[model samples]
Target: MKKILLLSDTHSFIDEKILKFVKQADEVWHAGDIGNLEVTDTLKKLKPLRAVFGNIDGADARSEFPLDAKFEVEKVTVWMTHIGGYPNKYYKRIRDKIKLNPPKIFISGHSHILKVQYDKKLNLLHLNPGAAGNHGFHKVRTMLRFELDNSEIKNMEIIELDKRG
Candidate 1:
């Protein structure tokens, strides 16, 4: 069993609250909009991190992370991207790719909207952790935590940071 801490759209902001959770999780998965390497580098120091580069990310981030991240964890396949749409309203490019090959879990971030839904057509779980940074229109910043045990994804929790600017 592996505890996973999933976050996105940090936008270069990192604080003690976020780090507290990081220390508790077995791994960290960043969806995107990282803003700069500082955010990720710090997380890496604490635990293993899986990440993708977002639209706002500059050359440094792009050079370090991929546009799309597809991998498996404890018998679960996960497909993650910075701009991947949710459910039926997925982005054209991501939708096209998913139609051909869908993962058990699909994660993305950009809209700064927190969504956790099941996509019936694709038979997958869609998770958007929203913006954990204070830079966006999001009223409340958030993050997600869950356990990947064998093939089961369970014990999910949401972490809400302070209000955004």
Candidate 2:
């Protein structure tokens, strides 16, 4: 089983508490809007990082973080991108060369709100961890965690900071 921590839209501030929860995760995925290279480098210090180009961040993102990434880990295949609507545009060139015909998980960010949906017919899992910082009219800080056993991904757990706090 692989435990993965996913977060996005930090804008420029990362909660120090994030380090506490993500310490033992195998990988940390930042979907986009990190606001600075320091944020990416900061998370890299914690664990292996897999990131993507966000609309607002990254000056040299394509060469460095990759616009989209496809990789397998622990028998699971995942596609990472900063936005949810452009999968076809991103995968068009690689469609023929990709060895894995079907992806088990798709992770994306752009909307600053947490969203998780399952397409049972297609066997697709979509996860958007939302904004981990204040941005886009969202005052709540949030993050997501996924537990994968074999090739099956269990329920996604979305955690949001209390508004009153």
Candidate 3:
């Protein structure tokens, strides 16, 4: 089984509670809003991290960091993005970006909402870990855990660190 820790919209800095979970995960994926390079550095100290650039990362159109990524883990194809190519928003450019490369598991952030979707059309798993850091968009603090084994998603966990108030 592949144990993975998924976090999103940190905005910079990370949750201390998240640190405990990171040690138990084989890999970590951050959806976006890293805020600064320091966040990445901190995450790396815990475990190998895979992440993407969020809208707040900066306005550099052609920055070295990619907005999308495809990775293979435990024989499962996972896709990573900040806002997600297939989002609720309406933007032709964004739509086009996602269409360029389809993946089995799609990860994204922006809304600060903890969500998980199963898309039959593309046979994909959409996961949003919500915001691990106190970015202040939502009233709750959330994060996710994914369990994959033999190319199948065995289970998932949505962890609430604090209630929104």
Candidate 4:
């Protein structure tokens, strides 16, 4: 079983509260809008990181991460991007590609909205951990934690931080 810490939209902010949780997770998956490479560098120092670059990210982040991250964890196929839409309202750029090849888990971030929905039509789990940083319109800073065991995803938990500062 692998403990996963999923977060996004850090916007160049990182605090002790976030690090406390990061230390517990076996791996960290960043969906995007990382804002700066320091956020990723910090996380990488603590645990394994899987990330994609976001609209707000600059050349440094783009050079370090991919526009789309596709890989598997514990036998589960996973695809991650920064601006991927959810379900029927998927972003146009990736809609056709998603339909053609679906993953067991699809993750994206940008709206700063926390979401965890199962796309029945495509048979995939969609996750958006909201804005973990204080730089967006989101009122609550949030992240997600879960366990991947074999091909099963279990013990999902939503981690909410203090109101955006």
Candidate 5:
């Protein structure tokens, strides 16, 4: 079983509250809009990090991470990107790709709205952990924690930080 901590749209901000959860997770996944490399470097130092670069990210962040990441973890296939829309509203570019080969779990960020949905047509789970930083229009900061055990994604927990303003 692997404890997974998922967050996105940090926009270069990192706080003690976020770090506390990083320390507890077995691995950390950042969907995108990381803003700077330092934010990821810190999380990478704490635990393994799987990330993608977002629209707001600069060259440095993009150099460190890819625009899209597809891989398998604990017997579960995951496809992650920064601006990937959810379900029927998926971004055009990724829509075809998803239809061709859908992953068990799809993750993305940018809207700063927390969403977790199941797409029956594609038979996958979509997750957007919202904005963990204070830089966006999001009123509240949030993150997600869950366990991946033998291909099962379970024990989900939503961690919310203080008001972004």
Candidate 6:
């Protein structure tokens, strides 16, 4: 089993509270809007990181991360992007592609709204960990934790941090 920590929209923010959870995860997946590379640099130092650059990310971040991250983990086909919409309302840029080839798990961030919905039409789990940073309108900072093993995703937990300050 692989313990995974999923977070996004750090916006150049990282604190002890976030790190504490990061240390427990076997790997980290970032959806995007990193704002700066330091946030990811810190995360990479602690665990394996899978990330995609966001709309707010600059050249350096984009250079280090891809616009879209597609890979399989523990037999689960996963696709991650920064601005991918959820299910039927998916962003136009990626809508066609997703319909053509769906993944077991699809992740995206940008709405800064925590969501964990199963897309029955596509047969996929869509996740958006909300905003982990304090830059947006989000009232609560959040992240997600789950375990992936033998093609099964289990032990899902939502980590809620202090109110945005």
Instruction: Judging by lDDT, tell me the better candidate of 2 and 4.
Output: 4
TM-score of each: 0.98, 0.83, 0.86, 0.99, 0.98, 0.99
lDDT of 5 by residue, 30-131 (tens): 999998788999998999999999999898888889999999999999999999999999999899999999999999999999999999999999999999
Whole-model alpha-carbon lDDT for candidate 4: 0.96
The stretch of ten residues in a row with the least summed lDDT in candidate 5 is 56-65
lDDT of 3 by residue, 1-165 (tens): 878989888877666677888888988888888787777777789898888888888754216457877889878888787876344442455565556665778888887988888766566778888888776668887889888888888769988888643
Query: Higher lDDT: candidate 1 or 5?
Result: 5
Residue 18 of model 4, lDDT score = 95
By summed lDDT, the worst window of 10 consecutive residues in model 3 runs over 85-94
Reference-based TM-score, model 2: 0.83
By TM-score, how accurate is candidate 6? 0.99
Task: Give a tens-digit lDDT track for model 4, residues 1-165.
Answer: 999999999999999999999999999999999987889999999999999999999999999999999999999999999999999999999999999999999999999999999999999999999989999899999999999999999999999998999
Tens digit of per-residue lDDT, candidate 1, span 25-134 = 99999999999799999999999999999999999999999999999999999999999889999998887889899999999999899999999998999999998988
Give the Cα error of residue 33 in candidate 3, in Å.
0.4
Candidate 2 stretches with Cα past 4 Å from truth are 86-101, 162-165
lDDT of 6 by residue, 95-115 (tens): 999999999999999999999
What's model 5's TM-score? 0.98
Cα error of candidate 4 at position 104, Å = 0.4
Which 10-residue span in candidate 1 carries the lowest summed lDDT? 156-165
Task: Report clash pairs, candidate 2.
Answer: none
